[model samples]
Target chain A: MVQALIGIGIVYIGILIVLSLRSRREIKSSTDFILGGAKIGLILGFMTFAATLFSTFTLMGMPDFSRTHGVGAWLFLAFSDAVMVFFILWFGFYLRKRIGQQSFRGMSSLLQDCYQNKGVGYLYFTAAFLFLIPYVAIQIRGVAIFLLEAFPDFISVGFWSVLIVLIMLLYSELGGLKAIIYADFMQGTLLLIVVWLVAFNCLDQVGGWASLFEKINESNRALLSPPGPKGLLTPQFLIASCIAIAMIPVTQPQLSTRLVIMKNYKSLLRMAVAVGTFAMLIILPTIIIGLYGALYYAEESTSGFLGTVLLQEQHPIVAAVTIIGLFAAAMSTSDSQLFAMGNEFRGLLGASKEDQLTPVRVAIIVFAIAALLFSLVSSDELVLLARLSFSGTGIMGPMIILGILSKKPMGSFMIWFSALALLIFILSQLNVVPQNIYSFRVDLALMILLSLGAFINYRLKK
Target chain B: MIKNWSERKLKSTWRIIYWSAILLIAVTFSPIVLIQDKVDPHWLQMPFHLWVSILNTIVLVALTGVGGYVFYTLKSKTDNDQNL
Candidate 1:
């Protein structure tokens, strides 16, 4: 197992290094580095978008969620993903048209242009930094913990966490967004293949589909039903999750940037549909593995269940490749987000265009270090943490919609409202405030308030 | 027929497509489609919630394809008008 893991890791790193080196040659200006000269085409666009959106969270978090939450996990992600992809189609068109008129930069810069205020830009960047860093950190922490379980006593989990961050920073600094996209292509492909392979093994272990569900039903009938055994997938939770996740392309910088950089609107539309299809295909396996876990490893620790199902039960070479795939999943997602953080900060900085690149790179490194520290100190439930990032960032969705849809500058009031909403959201997540109001999550309430505020504010303005 | 429509007409059509698509998406996942509690009448032996989720995916995919087709046709017509 050790030998196979080392071998696959070296090969994976080699491919990543080569892709970054090639990407380095494409770096002519900050535009080229950040948006790949805004000329990315259909295939690369879809793959990168899919890759960035689905990550270690999909690979590690989804199965566990499915195992614990029951069938409602499907509605939590796969259904929400379907909704988000359609939103991508609608938003991508508007974003493509707007970006064509104005040059491309980070989402923060675009919001700044829309609101005609530097403060709006800073507010957007601050929200991203606050929520996305923990998101990026948890991605590292998730795979690192899995890696430690796979190779116990060899190195601490923190070391593995730092190692992945270092890998992300090295390639991102060298090649920029293009490098990250290229890495995403690799990661996305490996994830699809590896997840399906693991799912097949799990299915075989449980004696196939019918048997798997039967075993789960026999153990806990709720696992075979809605809201699962934990009852975490209520209607409100599903609706709220759909709202939070569907806004991702509008609110998340990394994904929003991809929408603008596509070669044309046709490609963007195609990518949207392709991503929806990919979401369905990719999540199918996680359900299988989750069911397998529900049947066999229901009470086992997450590490124990994942360790056995992912590694110990699989062939050594397959186990090694799965490890590499998880690392790829983590790196691909983290690099895009970490790099977006850099771009977001760069937009906030009033530096000269020529001097901006270095500062952004430095900011990315600082964010990476902060994420590494957080990874060491913090461990939490992956799906909820990921959803927190989504919901936190989703608060900015109305602001982004206003920016994309309207030609005129928005009121600074919307910016302030969004920042306040983000604060309340973070507080709720931290348990500083109760997490729900009238059976709806706090983030859902904030989403409603922000959306209403955006609508009324704009309507009153006109 | 859409090809002969005015630009404003075409724009209105696109707007309709966009909102209707959004509505379709919402309905598929929302409680309106199927409540979660009932477990009878399994399709292919899959549970009610699970089948509904799968059905939602397929329905969404079809809606997206239809939406894409409308937009593509309209876009091409508009592009042709620009060239002429």
Candidate 2:
């Protein structure tokens, strides 16, 4: 399994390099690089969309959470989200229409129109940039650690993180989004193939569904467990996951750009269905792996295969493979993020547009290096940070959506909602008095409702 | 002023929306308000994962269907009438 995993990994890389070469001709301008001349079709858009959603945290962090909370933990993801899939469909169409002729940063500028406040737009953009750097670094390290775990002697985690970053930087600096998408299509296919293989093998190892459940029940009878009445599924958490997944197309800048490139309503609709279907399907293997991990290995002890697989005994060859798959997932996300961030920030800060691209690429290199330093220094915080960093948009989702949908001119409301969301996020992190979930929920809820009101009022005024 | 056709359409839309809201509220309060005495209220008994999945699937399918109908049927109807 290890040798085969390595062989397959090599072929995946080789294919991407070849595809990147084919796309080199298309990489001249920043526009060509970032938005792919606004010509990205459904396949690239759908794959890129799929790739961004598949990340290390889903592979590792989710299982980590499941260990403590059981199947009910997945609900933390499945429910508690309300924006619904409306955002997904709306995003592909609305943003595509809104972003035509605009540079990537120009899209953020449109938030000024929605929020009716340039200041709020600027605040949102700045927060987004600040949040992405650390998030990108965590993803880079996840891939690196996967390498370290898989081939302990050959490449250290830090060394592998840098290597992954360089590969990403190379393709990104060459053609930007054009290069990235071509690579994405390649990586996404590898991911799909690998996930399906691991899932099948793991299920076979666990002796199919009945035996799997038998093992789970035998392990302990807890409701949601064998004895538990709740079962493995959680309704509230599923609702949250659906909400987050629906919000992905809107809140994720990298995924949202496809809207700008999509030629028309038909393309947007096609990509939405394609992306959504692929996303839900691709995670099946990871979810199965996660469920298997609960029934097979101890949670914290199985964080990676290094100690259990290499030192004590055979943990599971499939686990070693899943770790690599996870690495692929994380690396794919990091590369695209680096590319997108480099594109946007380059244009924002560089003396010229071309210079912007250069700095952004350099920044990605810098970001990866910093992550390596931190991982070596204190990886605990950095490793767990991606899932938390994901909260930035979610923190502002209700308020931002309100601005988007408001019927009234809400130039002033943007600042209030921005402040409110920021307050909710900060207060949640501070762990002060009350220390209750509602502190975060009520504040976030307040922000969402107020912003919605502002938006409706604005629309009504017209 | 809006015509009789538009007025009737608005009235029916509101009617549907009100009924939907009532049904949703019933669903939301089912465990607590209606079945409070019957349902088990324990961390041990919370079927959080299973029911959430079922509800999410339901809501997801409903949202997609309603969205499809609105854009395909209602929006097009509005556009067609304007053209006429």
- Estimate the TM-score of every prediction: 0.94, 0.77
**Single-chain TM-score of chain A, each candidate:** 0.97, 0.81
Any runs in candidate 1 off by more than 4 Å, and if so which?
A: B1-23, B30-37, B75-84
Which candidate wins on lDDT? 1
User: Where does candidate 1 chain A have its weakest 10-residue lDDT segment?
Assistant: A347-356
Distance from true location, Cα of A250 in model 2, Å: 2.7
lDDT of 2 by residue, A89-152 (tens): 5554445444444455533555666655557656655655655666777767666655665566
Every model: Cα RMSD to truth = 2.5, 6.2
Query: How many times do residue backbones clash in model 1?
Result: 0
